[model samples]
Target: MTAIPNETMAIIAGGGHLPQLVLEGARSMGLRVVGVGFAGETDPSLADSMDAWQWQNLGQLGKLIAFCKKQGVSRIVMAGKIHKARAVDLRPDWRAAKLLWKVKNTQDDVLLRAITGELESEGMSVVSAMDFLPHLRSPEGVLTRRGPTSEEQADIDFGWPMARQIGALDIGQCIVVRKRTTVAVEGLEGTDATILRAGELVGPGCVVIKLFKPIQDARLDLPAVGPKTIQTMIEAKASCLALEAARSLFIHLEESLTLADKAGISIVGLRS
Candidate 1:
């Protein structure tokens, strides 16, 4: 891998393992990583991986930008998930309040785009986390020991476009289907909840489809799945998992594939 130019990169970390992965990737490429972690959302342990770290609440955009500028950071990467429902109680600073007032709605893409624009206006470019670790991107074709059966493949084919449509509308990235029938569509509750809900409604053998939003800014909010996803599928009795290849990040790929195979689940990476 080519080393990044001698510069410090600021990571705007949210939650989950992705932030740490991005930090490690940046360091491996010889870039200094300074992280600004969300108080409730980001993993507390993530601070250990950074050259310097500071904690801030979700709505402290002014502080985040100020920190980046103080550290002389020109590039920023936003990684991991932020639970949207929790934003209801966020104590927004004046800058964040101003940005919030400008947006008509709080949809994921709209809010993220506004945030990106805010950072760019301050002379900092927001970059995709995948640029640091391209290997984490899902590869095309079957990843598990078994490919999806004909019925499951049919369900995948049926659900793929619907997933894209919802994603294009910035509704969600994942949908659960059984025998070509919609079982559940993920919303604010998130992917795991959506899968478990499908299991309750359909009993078993449902397929989960996750994809990137067709109109989404790829630098922000890319779809991701990990070991916890397979665990959720096992509990939900989901039989197949399909993710958009190269656009979605698959964390712990080997371990996830092993668990899926052992549980008799099929995983496929599709170009769509």
Candidate 2:
């Protein structure tokens, strides 16, 4: 509910190239960013870019809150990838344990919303990375040399709403379809893995669809795709990718397009 705070903010740095990109964006806006990294998931070298930071393990919600309060950071941005499957290794402190028990299930939205509420209850604003990295939003149109073929487009049409329905159920944001048949639904392993798995199940010609979950908080966890996504589609021999345009983050657009074109893969950003 708070406006983008100009003074100080903490980024809950997860993994991948996104954390670095977000840090750079905060700098462009003249805001001080305190980086907080999750152990084993975050790249530690990223610490060098922070005004102040800490490497904390998962399930240390109390420590995360304590650090933010001590550093006087009132706004928080959750950025990058945190594998939810890593829950097996979590050692929850009192705050995190209480939160876990409070949620009816560990579905991504449920758990994340609880965590966001906890942070807000502590007087900190949970903001979106998109505010600082607006250019990353996927533009509406074909992104590669080729748009989907008629059949491929049909697959996209069939899969798009299904992906949205899956998202609405708070399941996952991605699905793979071929010839109008669902090949795979993304689980905690993530989009890339799900695409590759679809290849194993259905061979080539699969269309990958990723959407922004309908009930998702706009302030955190926007769907993202980029060069890595193109690479995965190529490896999966996927024929095309359909993203929720303007709602999804398309990272490294140029590079991703080049890769997709090279692989004869089609990438389109569709309106939801």
Candidate 3:
């Protein structure tokens, strides 16, 4: 594919390797990228990955906007997981505080939507996370060497609706179920912890389902799976992971698949 014109772009980074992945995408697209990474949340390695990097506190909206303007960035992308717990230390400048005041709810989606609006109003468009890495989108199929067994298929059908219900509640997107019983539900603690917890409690052979919330904005909160997800399943003794095909991102695909195969775990990109 031809690269996007090298107009400056800005990344409001969070935690995880997603920032690094996004940086790679931006550079490959021929975009000169500037990054504003969150303190205590974004990985430090991001600085070396970007064209220009600036570390900023999580709530510094005005500063972020100014930095992008200074770097001549007209398109912006926000990626990675910002620990929700860190919101307690939010130090919103007057601009951010004003935007926050306009929002009636502070759920992750609500807040992010507000931020997107605010950024757009400031003349910077928020680009989709997959703008440069379209291949990362989950494809339709049973990705692993082995497809889900009959029992796991039963669990997939069994847990699909319940898992969606959990996502609807804004609680979390991942649920580990055994025999139609939810052994673990992902919360702010995140997916790996939830899976490990389920493994310890449910023994073995649990099925893990991770989906992007039906209400989630694909441009921002797309569900993602990676090598670490495979490792979590291995540790949890889970045999299958059913993720939403096309909507989810499969990071480090070859390595993740290799790990899953070694662990005898099945990774399915469920159409649901």
Model number with the top lDDT: 1
Q: What is the C-alpha lDDT profile of model 3 across 110-148, one tens digit per residue?
A: 888999998888898887888778989987789989999
Q: Candidate 2, residues 52-128: lDDT per residue as tens digits?
A: 99988888999999999999998899999998799656899999999998899878888889999999999998989
Q: Estimate the TM-score of every prediction.
A: 0.97, 0.96, 0.94
With a 3 Å backbone cut-off (N, CA, C), the pairs that clash in candidate 3 are none
Q: Candidates 2 and 3: which is better by lDDT?
A: 2
Model 3 RMSD in Å is 1.8
Error of 3 at 130 (Å): 1.0
- State candidate 1's TM-score: 0.97
Clashes of each: 0, 0, 0
